[model samples]
Target: MTAPTPAAGAPDRAAPPGRPDGTERARGIRGVQPVAPLLGVLALGVCLVTSLDVVTAAVALGIEVALLPLLRIPPRTLLLRTSPVLVAVPLTAISIALYGRPSGRHWFDLGPAHVTDGSLTLALATALRVLAVGLPAVVLFIRVDPTDLADGLAQLLRLPARFVLGALAAVRMMTLLGEDWRQLGMARRARGVADTGRLRRGATMAFALLVLALRRATTLAVAMESRGFGAPGRRTWARTARFAGPEWAMVGVLVGIGVVSISVAVCAGTWRA
Candidate 1:
């Protein structure tokens, strides 16, 4: 007999050849392994942290700015995500300028704070460094899926499967917290208990959320244990986490940026320990 046809309303199961399914495509940055961006960020951080000079940070920041277009992030989303870094850079600069080791000609002096030429320079370098490091990290992790990251950690990096899976579960559960909080608030409002004593109401809601989270965690742990998640046998993955050319290239670019930034700082006699 001929093969049977699918049900009339059955969803299409076969993805187009050489193209990712909807779920994989939604994870973003197709063809680049999840671990690649993580490794790139780590390499960049290591390179940038070695120097406390303006030249190094400025160079890295400039390079990052030039490469932003390649990330393909929408302008609005980028701004919204990077807003924390933007706010933090100025605050960090101000703090460093006021309290960082005082040297050179003093610009301002207060009871226990001083702003000097040296501190000013340091502040500027620090601001740029924060922007350089924080911006790329924020952007790179924007579309990272918890499951994908866990897969990468376990398969690509050879991390402990139990730990990776546990952390992945925690991350997945954390996303539900926002919805839980909203539901709790609505429930409390319906009972007419959230209209007054804002601080007390918040504390009560938080305690309730904590209890719920604990219960959920306990249930999840039991379910996972029952499912052989913590078994001693070698674990297998559903999806292979590949570290290929694109991943390597991504890492190389970040490392190269770091190296060039440090080299410029050293050559310019602005390098610091």
Candidate 2:
């Protein structure tokens, strides 16, 4: 094999001169990228408070307070664009409220679990905690282009390259599936099969899409294996994570959130046995 010469002024060009490998080029992600400090703080709040750590929860909420200004994201745009996150945030709250451990003085006695002022208060706290924790994570996910995330995870966290990059490729395929799903829905409607009969046909189509998605996932996994995506050798990261001061700042933010969440819960008299 002959060593390929770089194309005129294009240092990273893979093939004959000006041509570059698709993976070699940097891809732009959607939304404003967050500094590592912010994400660190928010994610830490979620992880730390998960163990009912009041200090951690309080710190997480504090970061959220600080982030309201830091994020510069418009409210209308935030609500409309981040609709998925909005849905997720509350759903998470409901889950926590329903599943959280019941404690405190009993206010109303029910058949099984009594609904007490303490329980209501606990539920609200849990719900708030979930809402606070989930929104940032979801927002961050929205802003993070999967490619950048994959690169960052692999290079910064020293994640397994095969797993990280393979997942990134899979993320790209979802765009195709999104279109495929719309077309499938339209085709069913065109065939007069979309009306509400014994349950909506659209629901059936949606189920079919689920199966198709699972099938596609399995197929993609196999295809990746065949295409040397998993060939066991040293892999070089095309993009590197530049850990500036911001990254370390993110770590501190997480620690701060963890401490605060623990403290707040304890002070609020919401800590359970």
Candidate 3:
């Protein structure tokens, strides 16, 4: 197996990464279990309330925002995690604005695309809903190491141990994907084959990365099997993943936010089917 390389633009490992505030907060919340279940509950609530309840969506988003400061998530890390929403939410909202169920006063029309009060309302709700659903999961997971997460899943969730560990190993290699890509680019440049069409170069690099990943996966599997990993039997966890009071409180808070938001929307007569 090739030695692993650091990602080209990753921060140096001189000291532990993460902001002081975030690291401190992580200490308090680090070893909890049922992390996925909490996030799933929040996501399900967002889906139920977002379609025709703009007020509920907005309230839920506000609750999530408030929780961010409590979590002490640094701005840089938060930005990195939530950047996908910046692109995806707008595109999704635009599509809804242009082609959603038309009602109320018409705003504009272009070919098959049309905008109206109802669609514009839906667009705003959709954007808020995405933020409400996505931000919490990202913030919560920023401190979760993949190996620990897999352990939690296998133990608390009673998932297959071998599969969970294997998936965890794959996730741990994600940073290597970037490192490998950078190395490949450098190698190509050295061979005087770098100055090619951008699309073609990208395709070649991607294919090489895929092959590298497959090789690494094979090596990893062999190593694990050699250590009695795939044997069907009970396994012991080095660290216990407990879903105690704090974890339950966290889940309850999120559920309460969803319930309260929906109730308020219903009372305000803004809750639509």
- Candidate 1: global Cα-lDDT? 0.90
Tens-digit lDDT track of model 3 for 1-273: 998988999976654443444352233354555465455556546554545668978988887777678777789988988898777899989999999989999989999988999899999988888777777756677776676677678888888998898888888888798889999999999999999788999999999999999999999899999998988777887667777777777777777877877888888998876
**Per-residue alpha-carbon lDDT of candidate 1 for residues 58-89, written as tens digits (9 for 90 to 100):** 99999999989988999999999999999999
Model 3 backbone overlap count:
0
Candidate 2 regions with alpha-carbon error over 4 angstroms? 1-43, 46-63, 80-104, 188-200, 203-227, 260-273
Q: CA lDDT of 224 in candidate 3?
A: 91
Candidate 3 root-mean-square deviation in Å: 8.5
Candidate 2 per-residue lDDT, tens place, 1-273, comes to 999877888868345321155343332222222346345745565565565533445456666767665656667866776576556656655544444456766565545556655456555566556656655655554445676667677777778988887788778987888788889978888997776674666578779888888898889889878877778787775545666665566566556666566667667775543
Each model's lDDT comes to: 0.90, 0.62, 0.78
Root-mean-square deviation (CA) per prediction: 3.6, 6.8, 8.5
TM-score of each: 0.89, 0.65, 0.81
Q: Cα lDDT for residue 151, model 1?
A: 85
Q: Give the TM-score of candidate 2.
A: 0.65
The true-versus-predicted C-alpha distance at residue 131 of model 2, in Å, is 2.8
